[model samples]
Target: MKGPVSALGINLLGNNVEAAQTVIWTHPKKTEDIGYNFTTTKTITREELNKISKYIDDKDTSANVLAGIATTILTTPLKPYLSISSGIGVTLLTSYRSTNGKLVSDKLKKSTAKSFKVKIAYKYRQTGSNDGYYFIDTIKIS
Candidate 1:
């Protein structure tokens, strides 16, 4: 028997056929935003720090400061039982104090970095009482 003249001839004799084209379909991806956490470093100039210190000192005597103090007093009694919220109240009260501002300014004044890391947490709405939205859960500076 003679060998096939060509591969194309062999394919033709076998009645074999090949696809001439191909098609594909794709869809866009969807994303859901539930929550996120991130850390960012912020630089503060001496002038800015001084201004911030002054602002805090001024606010220290404001009604909000009194409210914070009252909140602390009311929450301290429940601190042992409800540590989370009570601790938050105490932290808020301390944050509104000139002493805290002085301490922070002094500490940063001695350092060359003059920068702080801010940790921010965000949360999405949970229930039907309100529309879905994002809000900051907490901001911690170090």
Candidate 2:
């Protein structure tokens, strides 16, 4: 009987291998998700008014005190663009009203002690890539 001629009998090949398939997943974007606009109200207190008056009379050039007050009173996702300006504006408006006899000061002579409410409207404005800031749309005091 004749058999296959081989010094060492071993199979060199078997089956072919398949390559892996890649799949990527992503979420859909909505128009509303891109930005937001809203309005909020805050009531001013006598103590806050006193602080603003003190800061104004002291002529705080850095506006840090005003910024702090703005951050607390204004409603925004992050630091508002007009935080410092808003604080100073409100203080000046209150002072003007007091001077013009529109708003009367309390015993402590604090114009802001009149206990007025502020209504603020904010709109998100985009500046750079995926970056934005909230800008004041309107502000009303009553």
Candidate 3:
């Protein structure tokens, strides 16, 4: 959480396949305009975590602290054993002020951030044995 007048980004997924995320912020000291908002969605699969593109609603398209995000349709690879994925994000937004909590950030600075993630079940036999996979009960671990 940033502040009372700012918004926090959080994501929740159902069944680990679909995700609902919100990226909204605010300038706490602004008297007339102090809102920022954007939404991001993603889907996790057996092989990758895919970014679902989104845009701001028409009603909020004219906000001061503008929020815009875009992600390529390509996928982020997931680890087989841990079922996890990690990637970085490069964002450009009009940031707010640190002192007065004002939406005075005039530059569209490029901000790069990394995000880390998980997914699925279905079995296929591994052919051409490299190392004999050890088995415990019915589970296989190499």
Candidate 4:
């Protein structure tokens, strides 16, 4: 059994499908201010893990770290945001992306010593796949 410390944290971060379609979708100059939402202290199920493993297996590669996983309703021109929102108490940074090109991943830098204020960026999916979402690199508390 996994301990409470091992529970998976999932954050929706942000959904910008509408924003990106309009002229108001101003790209952030810093890449950190893109509209994103966040969540922490989540639990990952075995089925989810299996799915992830299969995805990796199909790619013939292995990964030791992942931010999070999400799904969307569209296949193209979709932008999803995933972030920890603040850098408070972040200790490490690791990232991995699905080879299928359906997942967007990010990791914080090891130098992250403060809570994340909020990181924003556009998440584009595969050319013809309907996978859109940003996974958190880590969990941060303010």
* Number of backbone collisions per candidate: 0, 0, 0, 13
lDDT by residue for model 2 over 85-117, one digit each (tens)? Answer: 354344433333333332223444534346756
**Model 2: residues >4 Å from true position, as ranges?**
1-35, 53-59, 62-64, 75-114, 127-129
* lDDT, model 1, position 108: 58
Candidate 4 C-alpha lDDT tens digits along 20-83: 1111112233124443433333234444434443443334232322223222111111233222
All candidates' lDDT scores?
Answer: 0.34, 0.42, 0.20, 0.27
Root-mean-square deviation (CA) per prediction: 27.3, 26.7, 22.4, 16.7
- TM-scores across all candidates? 0.31, 0.38, 0.16, 0.23
Instruction: Give residue 32's lDDT in candidate 1 (0 to 100).
Output: 32
Local distance difference test, candidate 1: 0.34
lDDT-superior candidate, 2 or 3:
2
Using lDDT as the measure, the top candidate is 2
TM-score ranking, best first: 2, 1, 4, 3
TM-score of model 1 vs. true structure = 0.31
Local error of candidate 1 at residue 121 (angstroms): 2.3
Task: For candidate 1, give the lDDT of residue 4.
Answer: 8
Candidate 1 positional error at 108, Å:
4.0
Q: Model 1: runs farther than 4 Å from truth?
A: 1-41, 50-53, 56-106, 109-112
